[model samples]
Target chain A: MEQSFLAYLRGRTRNLPSVAVGIGDDAAVLNFPGTPEFPSTPESPATPDSADTPCLQQVACTDQIIDGVDFRSDSQPLASIGYKSIAINLSDIAAMGATPTAALVTLTLPSLNATEIAGEVYEGILEACAEFNVAVAGGDLSTYDGPLAISVTLLGTVTAPWLRTGAKEGDAIFVSGSLGGSLSGRHLRPIPRIELANRLRQHVNVNAAIDVSDGFSLDLDRMLASSRVGAELNIEQIPISDAAHAMSKDSNRSPLEHAWSDGEDFELIFTVDESDAAALEELSADDLSVNVTRVGSVVGRTGLWKRITGSKLERVFPQGYVHGETDE
Target chain B: MEQSFLAYLRGRTRNLPSVAVGIGDDAAVLNFPGTPEFPSTPESPATPDSADTPCLQQVACTDQIIDGVDFRSDSQPLASIGYKSIAINLSDIAAMGATPTAALVTLTLPSLNATEIAGEVYEGILEACAEFNVAVAGGDLSTYDGPLAISVTLLGTVTAPWLRTGAKEGDAIFVSGSLGGSLSGRHLRPIPRIELANRLRQHVNVNAAIDVSDGFSLDLDRMLASSRVGAELNIEQIPISDAAHAMSKDSNRSPLEHAWSDGEDFELIFTVDESDAAALEELSADDLSVNVTRVGSVVGRTGLWKRITGSKLERVFPQGYVHGETDE
Candidate 1:
């Protein structure tokens, strides 16, 4: 079974130059074209040539998906499981504003129908890689008696990579796409904002960035804590998805609460200087692919808050999906 | 729990310059100092200055451990489980003859006292990282209803990485340390032959290399298949550990059979040009840290064989632990 899987991977990853040693070795050896310094922003939005342009540095992140916890194998297609596992890692790469290059997948499968399920899962993984233009260099496969688990470690290259701790007090906070209600099938098929992030970095000075995976409030809190800053959200200005609004119909929780609490939204939350906010808005309006919403602003205070209609501010608690604590 | 763990990681990796975004971010940003070309072999055995030397490429590998399968949490220490998980990944790096740089760990835990057990597991992981000088850049943690699992993805840099397909027909095969009886307590604490691999590469031209994770016969078969070569083993020259002999007393299998079939030795099996075999042997004898044995020679025939003292050759089956099929 491992041999067949390895053969499948070898066929998939065979002619990639960056992958010096692929499926047959104990590890994959990768070679990146060297550069003297970080490349400046291109004047036009043309695809960068790997042969001519040099990669300065690499960024890396890893994410995992577990059956029943992350998704239900009985309900979701194996391809979606594979796609989501890769997408979430790519989201982290997007947060860093890096161009994803390669990924290594590790799978732990149960004894039941291992090979066929593994083949389906790998097809899904390859689909995501093909969509994102990432090479599936190598991976490890093992059997477990428990539910299926997939872990993806992705590597990318970035010139001026965005950091979560780069935000300033005078910056305006913004988010790409609407937020919340991931339970309504959005969590299983997230489109990682990789291109949008790179475009944003090229167009405006993104001071800090993060992916809203553990809910908007908690992810924003993370960015603030890392940058040693605070944020004040305008409750009316926050964009809520239709899914969140629909989910809020049967409960006391409003769409706004759903926006703040529902996690697994693989959207980009970034900060830009107050002076560049207008330019960012104009760029967002011109770009039809993504809807950028200015939800809040970085505040001088040292804690998160929400401003009500009457200019009254209330402290916002860091409530979101915490692992081992949150049910979802 | 995730926040505390991230804080703990921050404290540990704060000083590493390569780790641009250590923790509290979606991903870790790594900055590798650029070089004009691959650095030539060092004149002496002194450690290469990272700032001065140019790393040509990076190597990556991933491995996973699941409770009750890879280890029994009830019988094994949490630290040992953590140690073995990291050790196996490092062994892959060692097989590439690369220096381990960073690691990303993903863990899924059951509902039983996860935080404390995770902390102990992390302590074990950090201990191994400190010993190997590999940084725990970042990781993901989640909860599950099934058994606990840990997957580690490791990154390393090497100028000239040894590949499994580099063996020549006339190359002499050598293995570091004794083989067999890994189930007799050695599997949990098998040492990665990182330093030994580097030393072997520096002193001699290693044609091909692999770590003995799936027994000598099976792993050697993997290398032979990749290299399009075969091997003839001098059964008398094969090194068997005392534990293998002790285990053989309880079974019909001979110590030699255990040496060939028992997996998870985590030792290195490599091929070098016949000219450098004597030099490698001399170097190994001088360095008491590792034991090097001349086990076999690469052959033209496309099959594995063991030569008996009476000039009779017996075919060796490539049998060992295989994931998904093997119980252990």
Candidate 2:
């Protein structure tokens, strides 16, 4: 079963030139066009004549989707499970402002109907890879007696990569798309802001960036903690999704609360200088494909806050997704 | 629980300078000292002035261990489960003839007693990382209702990598350490053969390599199929462990069968040019630490054969571990 699945993947990815050694090896070997911009050191310069000097900076990350927790194996389509697993990881690559190159997938399947389910899962994975222009370099497959789980490790290349710790105090906060209420299939069908991030970086300076996986407020808290800054968000200005409004109809929770709390949105939350913010807004207006919204501004204080009514700032508690915390 | 586990890992890996951004971000950033040997093509070379050219060929692989399938979480110690998960990935890196560098672990735990089990698992991961000089760069943690599953993605560096398709018809097949009877504690405590592979590569040209995860015959069959070669094995020359002998006592299967079929040995089986085989054997003689055994020679025929009594050649069937195949 593992062999057949690998053969399918290898047939699909054999055309990629960078994949020097793909499936059927101990590990996949790749040929990266090394960047000469970032030299190791003056004392230890990378001489082309030397046989040991590396020429490319490898960017790698891993993410996973579990059945019942992340998605329902029985209820949800396997293709979405496959797509979301890869998309979430690609979102990380986008967060780094990098161009995704390749990926290695690891799948753990249940004993019954494993092959059929794996085929559907890989179909979704290949579709996503095709959409993102990433090669399915290689992967490992196994079967267990438990529910299915999918984990993907994405590898990419970045020069002058954007980091979460690069934000400045006066930078304006921006999000790539509307947030909140991902349970309405948005979480399963996220477009990992890969191209949007690249285009934005080409036009404007992105000071810091992170993908919202653990809700807007929590992911924002991550960027703030990394940059040692705070934020003041205008609650009314946030781009709440239609799903958020619908989800909030029956509960006491406001759409704003859903926009701030519901996780797995997979949108890019970034900060830029006040001057670049206008340029980004102009770019967004010109190219309406990406919905870039300005929701807040970076503050010097050490905690997240929201402007409710008037100018009163209320401290926003860390209330987004925290794994193993069931008291939501 | 995720935060506390990440904090523990961050504290342990904070001192690694190569880790640019370790944890608490969308992804962990690493600074690989690019090798200068594989220079970029001059036509479109990575300019020193540009900020995007990568300088190193990053080697990455992901492997997984699931409860009930890979191990029984209720019976097996969590530490071994953790250690094996990392060691298997390290084995993949070693098979590439690359040095193990860093790793990102993705863990999916059950809803109950997740924290305590996670701590033990991470302790084992950290211990293995310390032993291998690998940094725990970052990881994702989640909880599910099913059994625990651990997936590790290991990143490494290689200037000139070894591939499974590099073997020629005249190459000699060599395996490190004794084989079979891995179920007798060896499977859970198997060494990754990282250093041994490095030392052997430095001494001899390893044409092709693979780690024995799915049994000796099956993995070798993969190398044979990849290299388009065949093999002639001397059955009596194969080293069978004591546990294999003990297990064969009550069964009709021979100890040699276990040597040929039992999986999870984690030993490296490599093909080297016949000219360098003597050198590797001499190195093993001098070191006494790495047990290098020459059990076969690459043949021109497209099928595996064994030398039986009276010097007769018998075709060997490809039999070993196949996922979900229960007819042992």
Candidate 3:
């Protein structure tokens, strides 16, 4: 299988710049315009004073979506599979505040129409690349026993990459777009938020950031864990997605609970200094159609709590979505 | 399953630097160290005009190993499965003549022991990273109904990467180590020729190169195809692995036949100018225990043929395993 694919791939891939080295070598050789490490020696540069420069600081993350766990294979088309595969990686890049550059895809398919599946998947990848202006680059394909699965590794560049840390005690929390209710089909096709991220990178000095893929409570805990701090949320101010509101109306759960725990909302949950909030709000209005709302502050000790009534917030679900616990 | 795994991932991943924009944007914000379109400034030093000025280049490739196709689920151990997944990607990088820098992994699995599977797989990946000095940076994971599939994307850099198109008419064709009989188990544990690749990049201006993962005839055809030319193999000079010889002896097929058609050898096949033959041969002798032999030569013609009985070398199989071809 791999043999024939190699023959086909050698024929198909073309138009890359004159690579110093190409396929078939022990390793590939490439030629590129070199960048100075620092500003002083436009030639030699500052020699990269810090080990943490974005150039050296590698951004890597992996997310998993499963059949019956993340999607239904019987219903999801091959194009959706391909799009979703790359989309999820793009979302991770967005979460990191990085500009995606190259991507590598790995696929496992059943014996049925593997070539057609691959072609369709690549088509989906090409579409996403066009949308993001990034290259699909390269990837791996294999046959699997049971389900069709894809793993994509996307490369991105970060100039002043935002992190989950750096939030201060007085920081105000902001979220891009509404939260919750993604479980209703939107989970399958949620935008990765790449544009919103690019816009944020240009206009905001966000201290800490994370995309709300899991529930707000869980994702918030992640940010706080990185920041070595916690958040105090005003339940009344939480911007619940309309779908969450509708779901809450049918069930006994509050719209707040759905907002707190429903997964697959690819919105950005971020923290900014109090001084930057108003300007950020204005920028959000101008650049993002999505709502950027402030629902809480970074204060108190390192613990999560919600203030439904007033400043006196209460602890919500501590230890959001413990591994295997929910499955249990 | 994805949600739970992601929740765990958010916990395991540390907040690191180079985060031009950390985990919450549309796309990642990264600073690629150099200008894209122009020659390097005096300070940056444009590559010297020498024929051998090895330039920095990006080498990319991807592969997929599926259940039923790449491996039998219960047959291989989890640790081996994990190692093979990453190893396969690294092998592709090595084949590109590039030093792997990072990799992204995507996994789709049945709900069974997803994390355990991930842990084992990552353990394999981390081990390979430690061995190769590359990072297991990022990727996507999803579950499905079909089978356990692992896809990895390896990113690599090359000094003077080799190319298939660089093969000149009359350049000698050479392959590292022996070929054929990989199915005798070497296919499962094939070593990625990364070290050999690095060394070759340093010592030789390899004209054309490829790993013999596919059958020699087919893989050789691919190299010749990329060069837009034909090849004539000195069949008598082809190296046959003992395993391949043994297999042939058992099967009543000639060792020559297995050497020509067996897949998954993972050996490097390359071409270089005959003028540099002495230097390359000496270097291979000093650095690698394996033998590098001259097996064939590039020709002006555009078809692939073997050199048998004086001037007539008949056409062998065009290439090795093609994508989507049935395993049987």
Candidate 4:
């Protein structure tokens, strides 16, 4: 449903001038007619009264998660569900290399214990907002005879947004944090890579980026497909989390496949010019909130390929991984 | 659920200056750091590139509608459900006297026929956006084992926004369009009154305003409560719609009762100074897109009351009308 609907919407609204970035990416960036209030970067500190910069754009995206499918509403803490809802949307803004400002949350709740759930959920929402300094600008609450659904729309600002279509052949690809451990109860506590994205936005020439919400290989494929490019991943270089290794002990898939295909890691996959990728190594561990690993490079070849250090590159099989209801 | 949650949210986010208008209104008006893109009113007629006006505020509100509760998805046309979701949010913006700019739509789909429903819903969303000249700025899609829900967050620009807390003790109250017929199938096709709101923004000095999503008497009571005042409605002068009259034939309520107590009329209930109220009558019918009626007046008393043209006032009895899953 997500794929078919997104494709149809993209085909319908392809040439809209108001949309700087459209339906296929992490978030839609809109260029309203106005001068920027202040520079988005820290290169020059500007006050709110300052309007010396170029046009500013508004970035907006929403992600809706359900109870039975995304989480066990009956088993999980309501606060965790609320926190995940807002964090995933914040990740979408980070994927766009934008600063999150505010959010509008809509909760469609079941009729039983609605007030209790709403209050606890609001507590979680406030917790997430306080961490990001984002205002809970607006929201709606609805009750129905269904499982709880939390849909949050995060709004932000950007001047030079890193879009999915900007990556060219030969750009270096990097991903933040270890992956494939999310299903082991980490999905409810996502850490949006906002600070890393801000660092890249201020200091590097990022070509394209996406949050690994669906999976590493699948989301990387989406970004590559949108850019009309491909990538070559070094299988030996892909970082695996401890949870993945533990899950592999019981699961049919190996740790490597889990590292490549597990969803809701909330890590970031980004690309940069080779020159900037080289410069990225100079930053100490303290310079970043999360560890970033160089795993691949963009290529002109039209599909994903993987190879060990000494092996010939081979087409990466699909693995039949399902892209769930996860989105920006 | 709606009242208690709204009260809780209001108490939690009371004194944030960045939010020019907060939780207890049609929408949250945010004063972001920037000058105006263009004059929100027709009086100045400035272009977008010009920043010669005051600071611009963004009005954001979301309304989520679900099947079985807000509508019968299995019975109602899917397109009407989509249209109502967007239209209700648009009405929220109109209540703020803001011009619609863009919208973020989130669709939570039931597992079966998700793609087909999404397509039909998008058709309705596009149809509504075209009529209002609003850009479909962003959206997200998800599927779950629950009833379908459509939540739309409307973002708009406002220069001089009318709030729900500014009505003077003697202000004259007015409502747009005939009321009461909403549940007679009019609830599914709401009229946002955007043009009427724009007219009021451009010309009238609206003291306080609210959209009558609930019953007319109840919404009026809310605006008065926000204003710390009361209202005296002339029962005979209330504009009862033809649908209300038809519904009275079988319903256990009278037409007047229906006009005063039924919900989802999507009418605008507003207040103006007594002087400006007289001046409003000078405008011709073509100047406004909807019919305006002087149904009541703000009073110093503390609760809603009703009266005949020449009779004494009496307190209005609560009809046990549930507030339901509504709000900006």
lDDT of each: 0.74, 0.73, 0.63, 0.81
Q: What lDDT does candidate 4 reach at residue A128?
A: 92
Interface alpha-carbon RMSD, every candidate: 16.8, 16.8, 15.0, 6.4
Per-residue error (Å), model 4, residue B23: 1.8
Worst 10 residues of 3 chain A by lDDT: A24-33
Model 3: CA > 4 A from native: A1-64, A76-78, A113-123, A308-311, A318-328, B1-54, B113-123, B139-146, B308-310
* Fnat of every candidate, listed in order: 0.33, 0.29, 0.33, 0.50
Chain B alone, TM-score, model 3: 0.81
Candidate 3, which CAPRI tier? incorrect
Return the lDDT, model 4, position B130: 77
> Which numbered prediction scores highest in lDDT against the true structure?
4
Interface RMSD computed for candidate 4 is what? 6.4
| lDDT tens digits by residue: candidate 2, B14-37 | 233333333332123333333232
As a TM-score, model 2 comes out at 0.82
TM-score of 3: 0.81
Candidate 3 Cα lDDT to native: 0.63
Q: Give TM-scores for every candidate, taking all chains together and pairing residue i with residue i.
A: 0.82, 0.82, 0.81, 0.90
lDDT tens digits by residue: candidate 4, A1-328: 5676677786765344456666778898875544343213221234465354445677889888888877887789999999999999999999988888778888887777788888898889989988887778778887778888899988887767888898899999999989896889888899999999877765688889999887888888888998999999876788999999999999988988898888898899999999998888777546777778899899998788987457678899534246444432
Task: Name the candidate that leads on TM-score.
Answer: 4
| TM-score (chain A only) for the predictions, listed in order | 0.81, 0.82, 0.79, 0.90
Q: List, residue by residue over B126-186, the lDDT tens digit for candidate 4.
A: 8788788777777887777788888898888776688889888999999999989688798
Give the C-alpha lDDT of model 4: 0.81
